[model samples]
Target: MITSPIWLPATLFAGAVQAWRTALQKRVSQNLSVNAAGLVRYLYGLPFAFLMLGLYQWAFAPSAFPALGRLFPLFCAAGGLAQIIATNLLLMAFNHRNFVVGTAYSKTEAVQGAILSFLLLGETLSALSWVGILCGVAGVMILSTGGKRMEPADFVRALGKPSALCGIASGLFFALTAIGIRRATQEVATPDHIRAALIVLCCTITMQTVMQGVWLFWREREQVSRIFLTWRSSGQVGFLASLGSACWFTGFATAPVALVRIVGQVEVIFTLAFSHFYLREKMRGSEVSGLLLIAMGVILALAGTMR
Candidate 1:
């Protein structure tokens, strides 16, 4: 099998881009629930994803969506649904923890995605890359636990905390989503695979946006005003978030989904750096060390992937 060299770089760049956007989303979450924030970002992104899909279809192939059986759409939809849950959880995570830690929670996707793809989808990595994956996991562990393990009591306590639960749930949701998307896309034995995949992603996101708006309207009617007000205040952040999602989805499509997920672990470092430098937050020594570990892990993982 031929591997694309550019896929690694694309995945890395996507991680950086997504981290920047996640930071923006965290800022927006200061005034919104995870689902409410999802509504904002997806609504912001809906038109753009559609427009991009249309342009891709028009400029290249009008007959892109073809012969996808029922299962393909289901898997694709599952992927989108996973993202919806993940994004909402992410918002909650931001509320529960610092941006860096919340982001570290999401970086757990690397290990989870790898295992899921291997077991559920029969996809495996090279032995070298497996070592890289281990490094990536160790880095994430450092970021999340800071070389310390929670007491079992503390672990149980975190379960009662909505924010912590949300963040961990969101990371798990996204990891499951990545695995599903990989399965669906891999089965694209038809023409215009990328285009069809793009279409599926767009439609799923649109549905997720609508569903979120409805749910938030019913359950958090009082916060609707705040949601809109927050949107106005952080609308640009939403836009940046959409762009980041676009980059991430594109990167996922560009490479083996597992590889993309692994490289995406680098987001923790990027998010912490962004918070320290841009938000003017002081970085703890632990934070700096965590960043170094994550960076080194990613480099090793990428190196193992070299042909």
Candidate 2:
């Protein structure tokens, strides 16, 4: 049996909320431009992120708020900017002819995250954890293929496509974001992991809001008003995005970044549910097998942590 860890539940919650938030964001995108849709999460979520930080500070009453170290801002900025770019790349992939190829390659984040975490932070995972990561990647790849069987040669060729390259790059940047944030949390001068995470979350969100807001004003000025005009939906997306981010940041603070991301593979399960029920799509046999592999990967990763 897998023992309970705060990171496990935190990551799981983050993954579920993220899958839901993405769906809502897509709906908002239909009404707004891609950049505007991307901005909504940070722009509207800014207030809630602050609210969460304030509430946590009040409730916990840490003897002293953690002081941000010199490296804190650097990590936050790097992580924040990486996330923005990664998101844009993922969105760009959706516009490609073979979008699924991009989506599948993007799912390589778990593996990429592991590698980057090791290189950047010297974090190491167990042998089992590595296996779990590979399994999750394979599962995501299968699902991304929409259940189609691709020969080894075809799979290699697909990776050379423009969409595939975008997806691969997206995953790399996302891995960087995770590594940067995790390192940022470690830079705080406090023993309270949650408080450190909240501080980072608030700072990163504020920066992202400002950065994205400027871009919207300069390039997509027309969509600026539409963002607020569709506040009902945009607000919901913002709230969920903030809530999900809180859990993700907490996970990063409390566990190895790679392990947290490995568990986050569960997000695919939520995505599958949305496709089946919300989109009225049928589940393919390959998707079922992929789901099983993802579940197994999560279990193995979690179990490795326990041991």
What are the per-model numbers of colliding residue pairs? 0, 0
Superposed model 2: Cα runs more than 4 Å off: 1-4, 60-62, 274-281
TM-score for candidate 2 = 0.95
lDDT of 2 by residue, 208-232 (tens): 9888989999998998999999899
lDDT of each: 0.67, 0.87
Number of the top lDDT candidate: 2
RMSD of 2: 2.3
lDDT per residue as tens, model 1, 9-127: 65667678777666677688777766676677777667767777777777767764555556776777788778777876776676665444555556667777777767886766777
Residue 157 lDDT (model 1): 61
Model 1: residues with Cα > 4 Å off, grouped in runs = 1-3, 60-67, 88-106, 145-169, 187-197, 225-235, 276-282
lDDT of 2: 0.87
TM-score, per-candidate, Cα-based: 0.78, 0.95
